[model samples]
Target: MSEVRTIGILGGGQLGRMLSVAASRLGLRCHIYEPGANPPAAEVAHACTTASYEDEAALRAFARSVDVITYEFENIPTSALDLLEDLRPIRPGREALRVSQDRLTEKSFLRDLGLATAPFADVTDAASMTVALDGIGTPAILKTRRLGYDGKGQARLSTPADAEAARAAMNGAPAILEGFVDFSREISVIAARNADGDVACFDPGENLHDNGILRRTTVPAGIPGPMRMDAVLIASKILNALDYVGVLGVELFVTPGGLVVNEIAPRVHNSGHWTQNGCVVDQFEQHIRAVAGWPLGDGARHADVVMENLIGEDMERVPELARRPDTALHLYGKAETRAGRKMGHANIVTAKSS
Candidate 1:
């Protein structure tokens, strides 16, 4: 802990950018190791190593340059983890990564822990998908096991007739078929764990998505008073299960029976961005503290915040939102404005949203 002056981050995206900023605030330097050039994180990081994850020589150099390593996203190449971890510690650990990398494995882990989740089946081909649908029933979602995010690599099945389309979506990749859950709202709990085994969880925030991309996250999720405690407890159970150290985002479906686990993100999540303006310590800083072996900070909220993402062309609205009261804008600094890409976000703070 005392020797942690530099941190190495995998993937140089917006999450990495925020992490780098947080590390700087703590007087720690960040070194980004990403394959892409001019990554957002590289703008704020002290150094950047643009190289492929498969390049062991490059990974070895990155490992030697930093005291500890962490990642911005979950789809990291296992070979990189195997190589870098031998030189430095990777926080949140490999177990968390392994479980969250695949939808089937993640669901199984949750179910095994006695947590509630949607009925699911593994899909490898057209025949397998057909078999999975028979048991999971119609109105299901077919999603790839890896490298899928923000509505990519997924197709919805309304009935047996939709099987071909669902299978086609996989395009030969391994997939999972999940039964749908009729829920009132979707909420995510961002929790953190330190090396000392101390855990701190943020309040649940309700989410709204458009075409699989998160559009907004509203705090005080309107969860029934009693359900709030249960939500936090459920997220804590997952953190302890993996012996996880660093922040984990647990996405849950609010149902009448109880909360149904939807997915788990192994790093700082988009939904947790509201914490930037609402909480004493945001998810980004909490993650940095945990991985750096520092004490976690208070995650309590001082104001109700609604975080709205600027997807693609939404950047046009920034000029207007900038003049709005109590709004904090955080842009990703991406050069291209591809449709559905998260270019930035604006957090609207107040007593609460009506």
Candidate 2:
């Protein structure tokens, strides 16, 4: 309720770093609570606490230091939320996390909401896998129920013969079978809802992923006029369903029939990076504004923008990108480079078509 507020963020990655930067711009400060050493976000945050979420003392102290709390990533352990949520508010709240953290639950939640998603079935063991495979059929993907992202923890089944190998990939954890969908293109909507029930959605962005990690996002996604409106409405439906208070990322498949929900992220998403150059209010600042209880900003796009992620050795091209007048580079301050790592991104802006 004040001009100056403190926001505590969970997870210390690039999202946190950008969120902290936006918070600082708005005269708000950020405290980062991360268990990892040399976290990217810790470098830019006003304060950094390196402690395990299991430590109630550390969790409470982190909660006490900030006026409000949010997170850069999902996969936050339930135990940690149980400790901090009592002390301070968690924007987007636990309901969003609960549904998103588990693939099966998230799919069911979307289906129950009358949203279209890939056909899915639960699998906890070899027997269950057989049962699920029999029903959902071959050429499906087997994914762990929890904690899988960016091409990890997934097994592709081309035929029923590949079942055991797929089941073993779970490493004894619960899993789900999602029937493949033939989609024209993959797109995502990044939307924000503040505490006052106000909802604003950025223009949808078409996304391209390289080996499961997002490689690029382009605005004015090729979804025709009517489908784009449906995408926005689907995102808004989710935000309102959660009574969410912050930015949420909704990934969708533009299929022959309609838009099929892929998944939801309860924070600023990489797909929204194009907004930095396209919109008056970028996803990071929009998220910060919502978590800070401030009114939402303009989500209108002023330009056509394509955001390209620099994964690992792709950073080698930064110098070239920096020289381009229409390109804006946002590099994550990380010291090391390795394969599959997200090093930075570039936003290319152009005048909108008449």
TM-score of each prediction: 0.97, 0.98
Q: Residues 1-354, candidate 1, lDDT per residue (tens digit)?
A: 456999999999999999999999889999999999999999999999999988999999999999999999999999889988789999989999999999989999999999999999999987887789889899999999889899999999899899998888789899999999999999999999998889998889999988888999999788976787888999989999999999999999999899999999999999999999998889999999999999999878888999999999999999999999789999999999998788999999998443
Candidate 1 clash pair list: none
Each candidate's clash count = 0, 0
Which lDDT tens digits does candidate 2 get at residues 250-278? 99999989999999999999999898788
Error at 340, model 1, angstroms: 1.2
Which sections of candidate 1 miss by over 4 Å? 352-354
Per-model root-mean-square deviation over C-alphas: 1.4, 1.0
- Against the true structure, candidate 1 reaches a TM-score of 0.97
Point out where model 2 deviates above 4 Å.
1-4
True lDDT of residue 296, candidate 2 = 92
Model 2 vs. true fold: TM: 0.98
